[model samples]
Target: MTKQLLKPDYIFESSWEVCNKVGGIYTVLSTRAKTLQAAFPDRIFFIGPDVWRGKENPLFTEDESALRLWREHVKNEGLDVRVGRWNIPGHPISILVDFSPFYNQKNEIYTQAWLDYQVDSLHAYGDYDEASMFSYAAGKVVESFYRYYLSAQDKVIYQAHEWMTGLGALYVQKKVPEIATVFTTHATSIGRSIAGNNKPLYDYLFAYNGDQMAQELNMQSKHSIEKQTAHHVDCFTTVSEITNNECRELLDKSADVVLMNGFEDDFVPEKSDFASKRKHAREVMLRIANKLLGTQLDDDTLIIGTSGRYEFKNKGINVYLEALNRLTRDKNLKKNVLAFINVPGWVGEAREDLLERMNSDQNYTTPLKVPFITHWLHNMTHDQVLDMLKYLNMSNAADTKVKVIFVPCYLDGKDGILNESYYDLLIGMDLSVYPSYYEPWGYTPLESVAFHVPTITTDLAGFGLWVNSVTGHEGTLQDGVKVIHRTDYNYSEVADTIKDTVSDFSALSDQEITQIREHAASIAEKALWKHFIQYYYEAYDIALRNAEKRMKKQ
Candidate 1:
């Protein structure tokens, strides 16, 4: 008879974004934490860098009482850490290690890594040292914890995320051979660099050598650690099938398991609450747009937005702007369109004129001077969005039916202009477009759909491809998402497609729009963690089984 697979007795997961909400990895880890916590109870622990050493981290709640014995032992070993519970649904136990002391021994760590695993860190630069030190320290924390608490009979797993945490995964693999290691790279460093640098990523994906491209793009150190970790770990995984392909080509290794990023629906409002909150969202968004543009926008105005890290070409900011330009020129448009760029940028401050208008009850009729952006940027002349607006002569004239506004500040519910979070303002948008050229697994588009806002994304995005696969038909506004076919050289065609999509969506009836919104929510429902957490289990199984096999051989 075949034996049942062994599950991990304890799991230690580490990332640069544990309690720190830096990027999509935070979303992946935070949202999925509850499910894992429910299954394993107090057996799961997350380790992250204590970057917010002195500042109050709202995401973490430290408890001096929970792990008093372990905490005191680690402190004696010269590891400064805060034992806490992550301020999320599950409140999973977390260790936020202060890795500053590891910097003093950075060279020794790198040399040992090179000697043991042949991970090349000689050409490291930028955030490499910081990330590596933190990673190494995290690995040490896991090793120490396991030695004190766990035994050889226990099934243990240590999973590390991205290149930032690769060194830690490798370190744990070397030190605590009994602990299984899993390494997941959400996006390949070399692949993203190539796409960000304006190279033909898809068309020339086959020809580019990972090492050669890494050297050319100054990404050798990151690529080396990522590649080595993938090859060396008990289980290597990535977030999506799209990124899995990139891993095979760029990292010279394929994922043992494809652990797709999932979302939790606990954050979504109830039916009645959603209706009230959505109404408030629309009112606030429209009010801000009206004040900024000096135009009286009503409920009928078609509000559209695109937001992410301001990667001009990678996030398809350029294409989005070109689409708006085309839409502005089209004579067939009927309703007034207000397109917003909510991506964060280096801003000096909120526009004082805009602030006064928002604060006052008076309805201003005249546009503010240089009113294209809601805030003044540090590099106004050279900013990509602003530069494109200038190139296209998009002056936001009173007569123009389509107007574009850039919100160049983080919408942490405290920005002086809108004073609403991204998700809050997102619910107001009639449509959200993320025509990304190099998106790995786009949370923006997925979040837009989850908010019941129909979105237009491209086939290049992992979420977009997933939508296409699920629908079994090409995406369209009627289907809740329009997945436009995008390629390395099809920038102009993509812009025109988005322009056409907006025009088409404008003509839909109220009933049709409502149906689309319902469909969008349905698509988001399939991506919930409950339905998607099985992939993570598959990864854990693979890692554990492989670790057992390796130990038997040893």
Candidate 2:
């Protein structure tokens, strides 16, 4: 017989990315917040580190009157917190805790953790201390709130995200045994380290010992906390099937549920607005490209792009450059290709010359000095993209049919160059390519398809695997996304495939391109939070049941 599912009376979710837009986790939490809020309303609370203290946080709005009694109580108890609402579609109740005070008691906390949960922190360094302090503070906040507000009869689920919050989950598990805890690892610490270190992660995943590798790589503390938390949590979860395998091999535990990342359509512009935005985006891109390259890139020019974190090897930035270089040399290329690397780097400042040209009415058909990059970088000699371009001798010359531009700054709508947000610029692209070598859950490619831009990714990406499953065949740009089969040894083959794909896409008719865009949007519609939120519910049920079982034994 199927057991009755236990629903949560109160849900407390904590993450380092709560109100902080650092990486893919921010996308996961921010997009899914509305669905959770609708289900629990005021009962759901999000706890995050108060990194924006004494500053304006665009993603959050503070309310002095919220949780006044509990705020005063926690303040008296030496806990510093700011109660506010996250400025997202859901506007859920958010508590940003000041964890700086806990740094003084770090040794005591680590010692207790090592004794109780076998989490090794002796080798910890860098951000580990700060993240742990915040985690401990988050745990204290949950403990205090639970003691004053919740009853023993209430079913509570406290979910922590990534290793940054593992210590907090462990603390919650130990102090509040009655509360169910769920820990979700987006990617294993050792797994990412192995891949980033240029090791064959997939081929040697089963052979390598996670603990041994952690010691070798000086990642013992982070790995230890992640592993111990997975084993100790009421329910251990991951974002995708790819990461579930990583967890099994590295952490020696399997996920109770796979909570796949989902997107919300609320961010997408309506039909009429989307058309106008696309037109404006194309105009801005072409205007800048023309100014920098000293060429008149017409409306027919194929505008393609790739954007993500600047992990040169892991994000396949190297492969992308090689492919673009190959495409430039391809004689069969039918259209003018204006490819962009939207990845941010340590930028010095926007090009004042380019800015002057853009601001003025005169259309100069002369290339700017250092024409390949939109902004000046702090360490131009050391930058990977510049080094690769120099090595390949890609000058973005006046006669070259294929030109590449490096946008080395964040597209936060305030960056001096584009002066538009990432998504705003994204809608203007004809096609997008990620081709990631070590992506856990590729939000870039997924976001690309969501914006009706056909994307090229790799089977190595979690989103690619999901796309293949949905299409019932290997993905292609014709079908809205191309999932190139990638292995550690097939770098050249991947580059060749990307070149051929771009060539073929450029040859397609306008009607054909529109059809492909429609297909891309359809795939994105299937991945909305409405369809994927059930996995979270399943995770919550598992945590609740496991917590009930543990409490009964206690």
Candidate 3:
């Protein structure tokens, strides 16, 4: 037998929380850990911010020499304090960071100006100091950790995640020229910041806080530091082609390849008998109606659903609402349709204000189409919502047959709503709506398909673009999913599309519904975690190749 080619050692890493998630990066690290470990056990390592000790982490190593060296280096350099290590299964040496300097001051206003900048950052960039400071602190922490923790005998490769950890890889490479550095940007600063900004770039950056933001983007600052970090890395990877373009144009870094993000397979629930779940959901819906609206649902009404955070403009909540109003006014749909909205917002006083105004309308009557939005503001229990629905069904004011529910908050167990309730509602849904103006990639449509539920997502979403490319053209649109192209269109047209789509859905026969569900399930099975894992392997291979080339040159 010919000798088997030895696989190169690999290190898939980041500088964020792995098991304890602060953001999307955490999901990325945790989800792919097992697969990467299994494929390259001899050579693979997943590193992150090391921030635990003793029983807190399973890899509670008493490697006193490494620890002692790390302490000396940290003290000498006056580097911010963050310590912890958790080894990955299969991989002999895997780690995560726990920089207490950054994690501890997560809420502290390091500077009054920075705190002011944080608020502006939130509105303009959809990020806060937690992410901003982490980039700088993670870099310092990673650099210190490498100096003290790494062994000279060990052949090493480095991979950093997003802009936060990008600096970490660069710092390590400077000392160990023999090692190769890889940088992966799930989203670019320009892509997420400038493109996603509510205001025009010139207005937000140059006109408003131009001077302060300029300081923030200085040569030594995190923004510019991120750009330099990319330059120092041997290979650069982005999550999408769009992101690649933004990085090159904005950050001025050349990219080596694109590695799209993936989902975990196990998190997706199994497809069960939806009919039974739908029946229970309807009962719960009715009970909620009784408690919130003092009425009951009727069979004649059609339930339309939408759920997400309270970003009305970007998430298309206004677009959804406009469609609902138009659908409500349609003469043919007057008695046949109802809208169920679950977008979260300032449910407290704002919800009451909206309801009070609606209730005061001369045309308004008792047994409202939706229960009191206040129930959401109060953070009512899920069982409480169910009980309220049951009460509404018992009330004569509600038709008990009408189909509709609007949940104006995020669904969590503590909120008393299980995902099962949402899943059941989705199974019974006439349609699920998502018209996001700006989404890195949407998970809702993919999930909707897995549940055999039809959904609508805009071309703006990463998943939507992928699905359109996969499904449109050669096939008729009917397989339980319909992608409505927003294509940089106006608001009115979007509203019309939603209204028209709902009308079309109402007209579909049983055969078409079955086709839609089947298509959705087919799409989900292929697009889910099974397909996403390959990217990790490809990224790992590329990183190692770059590392080996460096070794040979030395």
Against the true structure, what is each candidate's TM-score? 0.98, 0.98, 0.70
- Per residue, candidate 1 scores C-alpha lDDT tens digits across 119-156 of 99999999999999999999999998998889999999
The TM-score of predicted model 3 comes to: 0.70
Please list the residue runs of candidate 1 whose C-alpha ends up more than 4 Å from where it truly belongs after superposition: 1-5
- Candidate 3 per-residue C-alpha lDDT over 71-160 given as tens digits, one digit per residue, 9 for 90 to 100: 666767756343333343332344444454564654452342233222222232334344445444545555555555555454455677
Arranged by lDDT, best first:
2, 1, 3
Q: lDDT (CA) for every model shown?
A: 0.91, 0.93, 0.56
- For candidate 3, the clash count comes to 32
Candidate 2 TM-score over all chains jointly: 0.98
- Choose the strongest candidate by lDDT: 2
Measured over all alpha carbons after superposition, the RMSD of each candidate to the real structure, in angstroms, is 1.3, 1.1, 8.7
Q: Which stretches of candidate 2 lie over 4 Å from their true place?
A: 1-3
Candidate 2 — which pairs collide?
Answer: none
Residue 407, model 2: Cα distance from true site in angstroms: 0.3
Regions of model 3 farther than 4 Å from truth = 1-8, 15-17, 22-27, 41-96, 102-157, 199-222, 253-255, 271-275, 298-301, 331-338, 346-408, 417-430, 472-477, 548-554
* Candidate 3: residue 420 Cα off by (Å): 5.9
- With a 3 Å backbone cut-off (N, CA, C), the pairs that clash in candidate 1 are none
Task: At residue 527, give the lDDT of candidate 1.
Answer: 94
